[model samples]
Target: MQNYTKFGKNININNIEIAVKTRLGQPHETMRNGVMKERKKPGLKKARKASQFSKR
Candidate 1:
């Protein structure tokens, strides 16, 4: 089951919780090269792809 916190800053899936943490104040694409972009979690990435495929 997926649930959101009161403020909706993070997400809880099954028993694993993942927070939507962003880099700096702006998106990484907008920055030149301050720091490497935040890599997406493998499990979350896979789940996202699966959800997209299911939507189609």
Candidate 2:
């Protein structure tokens, strides 16, 4: 069988089974990564980060 572990292809079936059992089968959550990125706010520099200000 193909190696599902991220380590390498030298892994055995037992190790693969254990990895699957432990829920480490695949690294990526889904086929498309970062598809649901948070939208930046209208006023904020970033999504939630605002510009820094200082009082003289």
Candidate 3:
């Protein structure tokens, strides 16, 4: 299992689970920006890297 951050919370979109990081009132550009910001977080990046290495 992967650890989910606040920005990468799973949401149901059209019956599919998608990871979104923006607020409901935010614009589309905000969603992109939010994902970019989330990607820059060291903790999240580290967690992702760790998960990848564990899969080997």
Q: What is the Cα-based lDDT of residue 38 in candidate 3?
A: 31
**What does candidate 1's lDDT look like per residue over 1-56, in tens digits?**
23323323332333122222221223222222433355466899999999999999
Q: Which stretches of candidate 3 lie over 4 Å from their true place?
A: 1-39
- List candidate 1 segments past 4 Å from native: 1-35
- For model 3, residues 1-56, the per-residue Cα lDDT tens digits are 33323444453343122233224322232244334323355788899999999998
Residue 38 of candidate 1: its Cα lDDT? Answer: 53
TM agreement with the true structure for every prediction: 0.36, 0.20, 0.32
lDDT of each: 0.42, 0.41, 0.43
The better-scoring model by TM-score among 1 and 2 is 1
In terms of lDDT, the poorest run of 10 residues in model 2 is 28-37
Candidates arranged by lDDT, highest first: 3, 1, 2
Residue 4 local lDDT, model 2: 46
Better of 1 and 3 by lDDT: 3
- For candidate 1, the per-residue lDDT at 41 reads 64
lDDT of 2 by residue, 4-32 (tens): 45533454444544444345433322213
